[model samples]
Target: MDQFILTFLKNASEKNFQQLTGRFLPHYFTLISKVGGMISPETLTSIQKALQEGRLADIVSKIQEVITAAENAVLEVAVIGESGTGKSSFINALRGLSHTAEEAADVGVVETTMHKTPYQHPKYPKVTFWDLPGTGTPNFLPDTYLDKVGFEYYDFFIIISSSRFTLNDARLAQKIKDSGKKFYFVRTKVDSDLYNEEKTKPTTFKEDRVLQQIRDYCLANLSDIGVSEPRIFLISNFDLDRFDFPKLEETLLKEVPCHKRHMFALLLPNISDASIEIKRSFLQEKIWLEALRSAALAFIPCMTFLMGFDLPQQEQCLKGYRSYFGLDDKSIEEIAEKLDTPVQDIKGHLKCLDFWSLVKDDSIVAKSINCVEAFCAVNGGPSSSVVQGFKAYILRSKFLNVVADDAKHLLREIETVNIA
Candidate 1:
C-alpha cells in the first residue's frame, strides 16, 4: 500500500490523475521514509498506465489502500522539563483535554510522571504525546536522561520551564540536539506572572513591559548558560490565547515530517485564525478524497444502493469539522462562557446550510454544483464518466468553505475582544 502511494504520487502529473485529484494535492516526501526505499519498476508502470488510461476502478482500490496508509502514519511528541514547569498542563492543552479529564496528564503538587508516560489524543489516536519525568532532580543527569527515557522513540522534544531558564534545560537541549533530534524550549505560566504584576504594581504596570521583561529574562538566562540561540516560546497553559502558544504550534507543524503535517494540523487546538486555516486545509484534503470515493459509488450500483447520495457523507464530514474548529454549539458555548459574550454573538458567525433548498435549481449549493458541471463540460476531462467524478467534489468543497469561513470569523471576534 505504501509503495503504491509513492508510485501514484510520482505519476500524479499524468492527465487523467490530475483531472480526478484536482489541485489540492499535498506536499510530501518523494518516498515513504518510514516504509523505506523506491517502489519496484513494474509497480510504477502499472500505476501510471492505469491512471493514463482513466480506468477509474483499476486504481481506486490501490488509491484507497495508499490513503489509509498515509492517514494512519504514527507520530510521537515528547514534552520534557523540570517538575512544576507546567509540562503536564501543556501536554493536556496540546491534546485538547481538561486537566481533570480521565486521560489527561496528571497535574498536581507531586510529580506523577516519574517515568515517561504516553497520552494518546482521543480523536487522533495515532499521534501520541509523551509526558516525560522531570529533569534536574538529584537522580537526574543530563547525559543519562535521554537513554533512561528511551529518547529515540520521539520524533521531536519540547523542553519546558515556568521561571528563569536553567543550566539543566540548556544541557538537556544540547544533548537532544547532539543526538540528531529536534527540540523546542518553552516557558509556561505567563498568565500568572502578568496577573501578579498587574495586581502588585497596580498603577504603573504595563502588560507589554512585563511580557518583554519575562521574554528578555528567559533569553538572557539561556544565553548566560551558552545557548547562542534558543527557539523559545512563552505560553500560559491555563490561557493558550495569552502568549506564544500559537507560534509554538505553528513551528511544530512546520518542523514535523510532511506526511504527518495534515494530521498534526487537524489535531491542533483552535487558538488563532491561522491555526484554524491549517485545520481547514487539512480537512479539505479529506473532503477531496471522500469526493472521489463518493463519485466512485456513482459507477458502482451496489455501493450506490448501500451508500446513497453524497449528502449524508457531506453532512457527517461537516459535523466532525465543526467539532474540530470549535465552531459547534457546545464549543461556542464554552468559548462564550470564557469570554463572557452572548452565545448568539459567536454562533451567528456560522453560515447556515439549507439542505432542502440546496436541491432546488436556484439555490447556492445548486449554483455551485452547476459551476462544477460547467468546469467539467468545458474541460472534457477524458470523458463524461470522468466528469461525474467532480460532482461530489464541488458539493463537499462548498460545505467545507462555509465551515472554514465561520471558524475564521469566530476566531477574529475572540481575538478582537481580547481573550486575555
Candidate 2:
C-alpha cells in the first residue's frame, strides 16, 4: 500500500493530486451511501444527525472536513537545555536551518534566558521549537522554569545536555515526569567528541560502536538518576545525522499522541529519506485544505494572487517543497559555514527549471533569506554579481526547480498509501 501511494505521488502533477484529495471525500460518501443501509445503526444515527444539523455535504465536502480537522490538529513542543549546550543550534538543525546568519543568537554558557524563543516551522507553523533556558542552576527550580516557559503549551519537553547528566538535568527531568509531561534526554556535542576521538585514535574502535557506548553510558546514568526506562538520544548539533536524530524522531512519534505526531515529524531536520517521508506525509495530510482552496482558486475567474507580507505566498508553498526535498536554505547555509564557503557559493547551483517559472524574482529578503545570504557572503561566495542582459527562453517556469519534483513525488506517495 505504501509503495502504491509513493508511486502515485511520483506520477501525479501537483494540480491533479490536490483535485484528487477534494474528490476523495465525495467519492467516499458515495460508496458509503451505496451501502448506507449496511452501516451499523449507530453510524446511521450519526449520518441522520449530520443531515438534520445541516452539516452533511456532498462526499467532497465531507472529505474536506476530515482533512481540515487533521490539518488543524497540530502539536506544540518545547526544547529546553543549558546554555552552551547548543540549544539554539540544535533548534536550527531540527528546523532544517538555512543560513548561519539567519540562525538565532546563541546565549552564553551561564546567562539566564528570561524569555521563551520560538522558532516556528516555516511550512508547518503549528509545530514550533521553543528554546527554554536551562534550569540547571544552583538556585533554579525545574517547576519554576516550566512555569516561566508556559509548560502547558508544549506537548512534550526535550532536555538537552552537552556533557554528563548533571543534578539540574535530573531535577528538570523529574519535574517534567511529575508534571505528567513526556521528556527526552538529548546529549549534544557528539560531533566534537567524534572529532576529538578521531584525532586521538585515527583508526580505533568502530564509530558506530563508540556512539552506542556513549548512548549506553548516558542511558545508564539517567537510569541511576531514577529516570527509569530513560531514553537517551545522542546528537551532534553540528552533524544532525551523525548521532541519534532519527532515533529521537521515531521515539517521539511513538510517544506523542497520534493526532499531533505528524506535525512534530514535519518540524524535524530533513536529514534522510525517512525524514523526508515523514515531512511529506504530514504536509500531505495538513495541506489538504489549502490544496483544495488552491484548486478552487485555480478555477476562479480572476487572477487571485496568493500574497503574504512575511513570506510571499508563492514562497510559502516553496517552503513546504524545500522541507520535503531537503532543500531548506538554512541547511545550505550551515553547510557553507562548515566548509568556510560563502553562502552564495553554496547557492550558486540554485537555478530555475527549464520551463517552470513560479518565482518572478529571486531576491531573498525575509529573515530566513537574509540570514542565509549573510552566512554565505561571510564564508566564501562572490562578493557581487554583474548585470547580465542575456535571458534564457523557457516554455513554462516553475516556482520550485527539480526540488519541487521530489516533494511532489513524496506527496503522491502519501496519497497512495493505505493508512486504513
Candidate 3:
C-alpha cells in the first residue's frame, strides 16, 4: 500500500487524482472530522489546489488546527443502573482496570452507588465514565431524576441491568431521549446466565438458544415501559469479547460525533479483533496528513520517530504503542490478573516480538522507499519535509499494524475456555 501510494503521488495524473478523490468522498451519515484529519473529496481538492497555488502555509495551518482539536476532544460517558447490577464492575472493565486496581470503581451490594461518581480511564483521562445513581433508588422522586443526576452533562448514557429492565430504567431512557440524548440498554452478568444454563441443562444447551432467550426477555421487559424496538446488549463485564459487547462498542463509535471519535477509538481497550481493527483503521486514516506534517516538521505524534530522529522521542513513541494496544507492562499485569492466567501465558502470545527485529529499527522500511525523496519533491531538490514525513509515516504505519496484531493475538490467547 505504501509503494502504491508513493507511486501514485510521484505521477499523480488527473485520472489518478480523480480515483483518489472518489475513494475519499465524504461520509455524511456517520462521523465528521477536521477537513484534513480524515480523507474526503474536499480534503483532496484542497490539498491539490494548495499545491497548485503554492500555498503550503495554508495547508500546514489547517493540519495543525485539526490535530490540535483532535487531541483536545473530550467524551463523557455515563453508566447508570441499580446497585449490584454490576455498574461499577462494568466501568472498571470498560476502563480496562482490574477490581484490585486503585483506580477501579468501587463494587457494591444491593444499593451502594449513592451519588454520581466519575471514573477515568487510566490511560485516557479525557474519556470519563460516571457511575450514576440508579433511577430506582428510593431517595429521589421519579420526576426529578434527570436534573438530580445532571443528565445534561453526559454525552451518552448506558443503562445496565443484571436481570431485566425495570420501570425506573425505562423512565430514565424516556427522559434522556426526550431531552435529546442517546442511551444504551446493557444486560450485564451474561456469563453467569450462560454458565447456569450450561450447568443445569448440559444435554439441551445451545449458546445461541440461551442468548436468544435472554434477549427476548430483555426486549419484553423494556417494551413494557414503551421502549420501541429496544436494543439490549447482553454482556459479562468480565468477558467483553463474548456476546454483544463488541456490538455495543461499535454502536457507540458510530454514534459519537466525528470530532470526538478519535480519542474514543484510541482509548478502547483491546477486547476483540474487531476492536483492534477499528483502532488500526482510525490510525491509518491520519497517516497521509501526519506524513505531510512530518515532512513539514524536519514537524509532528504518529508523525514522531525519524530514522535519525531523536532516540528518547522514539522510545516514548514505542511506549505509547505498547500502552495504547494494551501490551504495556502494567496493562499486561492487569490483564493477567483479570484472566487468572500466568503473566508468562500472556507474553507467550506475543511471539512476533522475538523474531521481528525490524520493528525495533526498521531500516528495511527506509530502504524499500528509495522513491520517497522523488515522490516528496518535484520543483528541484528533495524537500526535507517530504522526506521526513514519508519516513515518519511508513515507520509509524508499520508499528501501528504490529501493535494491533499483537493485541489481537494476546486477546485470543487469554480468552480460552479458562476465562469463564
Best by TM-score: 3
Minimum summed lDDT over a 10-residue window in model 1 is located at: 31-40
Model 1: lDDT to the true structure: 0.68
| C-alpha RMSD by candidate, in order | 7.1, 15.0, 4.9
List the candidate numbers ranked by TM-score, top first. 3, 1, 2
Tell how far residue 15 is off in model 3, in angstroms. 14
User: For candidate 3, what's the RMSD?
Assistant: 4.9
Q: Considering every candidate listed, which one attains the maximal lDDT?
A: 3
**Model 2 misses residue 75 by how many Å?**
3.9
Model 2 segments more than 4 A misplaced: 1-62, 107-115, 122-125, 201-203, 284-420
The residue ranges of model 1 lying beyond 4 angstroms of the native Cα positions read 1-70, 285-309, 327-388, 408-420
2 or 3: which has the higher lDDT?
A: 3
- Model 3: per-residue lDDT, tens digit, 1-420? 354345445534222344433333342212232222233345556755654554545556666666666678778998988878999998888888777778888886657688889888888888899998876667756578888878888999999999988888888888889999999999999899999999999999999999999999999889988899877899998878889998888888878765577778888778777778777777766655555444433322234323444445545665677787888888788778767889887777773344236345657446435655555454345555455445556666776777788888777766664555
Q: What is the lDDT of residue 317 in candidate 1?
A: 59
